[model samples]
Target: MLGKLFLLSLVCFFSLNFLSTINAETNLIADEIQSLKVTNKDPRMINFSVSLTEDHNYTSARLFYFLPNPSLNKSATRGDLNGIQSKFNNFYVDFDTNKGITGSRFIPTGVTFEYYWEFTDVNKNNYKTEMQQYLFLDGQYEWKLLTADNIFFYYYGNYNKNIQNCFLESVSVVKDGSDLLAIKVSYPINIIYYLSPSDSRYAKPTRSIVMDSMTVLGGVKYTSNVVHSYDQDCGVVKHEVTHILNEIAGHGTLLKLPFWVDEGFATYMMNKSDYYDNIIEKMINKNTVIRLSSMQGKPGTPEKVNLYYAQSYATTKYMIEQYGLEKYRSFFKILKEDFVIDEALQTVYGHDQDSLYLEWRQHKGLPIIKLVKIEQSSIPIPVATITPLNFPSKTTVNQQEVENNFSKQNNSNELAVSNFEIFINNYIFIIVGAILLLIMIKISIFLWKK
Candidate 1:
């Protein structure tokens, strides 16, 4: 009986010790942090405030935050709170969203951040408050959310047909794209659509032109599975969501997939309209279809932009139709393996860019224009070297004349590009002049009416 009593006492002693250890750890944070609050001061700033318990005195404090990316990983951002304030057992730190004390990367509005506060006591013991989530917004509008198929659409004002269509179409695109590409979208994608173009200050700002005193932003996708747009067009949603899928497929690869492949795939997924079809047909007739090598980047001029998208769509369409989507999928897989466009084409389609272009043209039943066989080099200079090749067409064209005409065409293209650059360089002056002209016209019309 005495032995049993001693064992019971021993058990009670260890249980008390264990309970005390847990209670001490739990109180460490609770005792230091009395209350915590985060406020979105405006579109450009956020204020963090924390009150500590009277028992503990702290000499140092820090705010740590995290921004999650699509790869299921997070980046940590820290701010020193020592100098900001520490009176009445309270601490305050104001973080500038634009400057992003974290780094040079810009953190746009509407992104959710997880943050916590850590305090160092005079005894050098560190205590951290519980993590909390804060949604960064402009705090100027009341927003509403609609969820469908892992997509969250946030908007303000009345729920109109346009928003409904955007929501439904975005859901369909996500489903179809995920199944087609075998990509599982495990996380929710947040899309913030501004109901009024006037409210664009709250949306992600881009380098955009102001036309007719309104901002035009089709759509933009960020690496964190966040999308921002001002329009409710279903086509724009399809295009942007396709880019999200493309990003998922190529995630973790060092080199980015070429612009042609990326944008072309997005365009193809959109299911082109009659206007796009007309553009492709017209470019084919002019024999000005941009070569694959020339399609390394996006075009500058509006006309070239139209031609670029049209031709890219046509090229991607031909590949999927002629060879089959499964083969195209294999090609995409190769591209994800860090192979360049030329090598990926060669491996999957058994041809290079030149041959693929030739075959696509043949598929279109267009007149065969012989492309100069330029020697491949480590660094591709835009200079095209001409080499004569036998043509399948029975009609003989003057080789010398063709070369000379090609040279003139290249020169004319360069001149047009240069002129466009000059126009773009004077963009600010042109905008100011156009605005002045509009104001003058308005005043004249008012006087005439009077």
Candidate 2:
């Protein structure tokens, strides 16, 4: 009897200790933090206000961020979780000076950010806010913000006569596309652009990292730089603005997309059907055309990328012309609604993707793709897993209940992504960006020395 009683007491002790640890968030520690708030004051400054319990013991604070790509993984590029001392000032700690945090790399315009803050106390306890997001833009520069019924445009710079006289050029092209397709350009479209060689306040990484200027692609990031390409200036601008509309249609920038349809449709709308048409016949003849799915999650080399883009343009143009734009637009929306490519094709074209591919090949007078296996390059994409939960015996489980939960529980939200996994995807882009910036910085240093 005494042995059993002693064992019961031992178990009770450990259980109580475990419960204490689990319930600590609500514990009445006098040093507990009371309130935390943050706001983006401007392009260069962020304001924060924090309050703590009467017996607070403050330690330090830090921030982590990334450049917001306009693609599905909006801010895939990660940067240092740089720190800023909170040096107490009355009731708040505001980072508003040049000494705080300011630079083109850290605060580029038109790029969005995914960021979070962490605060640690003297007790070694860490407190953090849920990750928040924002897009940085050149709000300071606004020469004209125009609205043409539903289409819009924002331009800044001295090229008012050169760039703004035909501000409605892209609007006109898309309007033609709308009339042909029997679809509307969802209201309040922002066709933001500037025609200047010295337009520096653009999106990051690609903002300054212009590639092979001999063949300079005419877009600052996602918005076109009109001064670069006079011949196809409107085409470039229309292509990019169409991308913005597509992003909205795809239910924002975070959702995964089939890039073929996305870019292809954009190219068609921009009237760039023959962007890279010269390579298509040769590719089809040599059986080197990339499969449609290859465009997802990974980008290719510059040459190969152009080929893919051309193929995308060709396919989308064919669909729109042959099957009527109304059906094509419905098809695009279904794909946007998260339907698999195969299912989307089947629903729209009365056949699977493979059948659709064959039909497209037939239209092009090329042989049908047979049993050739396309090898997929492995990428470190995280997939969600679930562990079966065990509840108390009193809880009831049923067939329908179990079936409903299988999907929700194993979705991407619950993936086991480590810090390193998140960092790697962002780090590669950062390295490229850093290399470009460093090259310019080195040249500047050399000039200064001279």
In the range 17-43, model 1's lDDT, one tens digit per residue, is 444433332225455566788877456
lDDT, model 1: 0.61
RMSD, one per candidate, in order: 23.6, 19.9
TM-score to true structure, per model: 0.70, 0.51
lDDT string, candidate 2, 411-443, tens digits? 112222345677675365555555555565555
Cα distance off (Å), candidate 2, residue 207: 8.3
In model 1, pairs of residues that clash are: none
Clashes, model 2: 3
Where in model 2 is the C-alpha error above 4 Å? 1-143, 150-152, 159-162, 173-187, 196-198, 201-203, 206-217, 220-232, 250-255, 274-288, 373-450
Name the candidate that leads on TM-score. Answer: 1
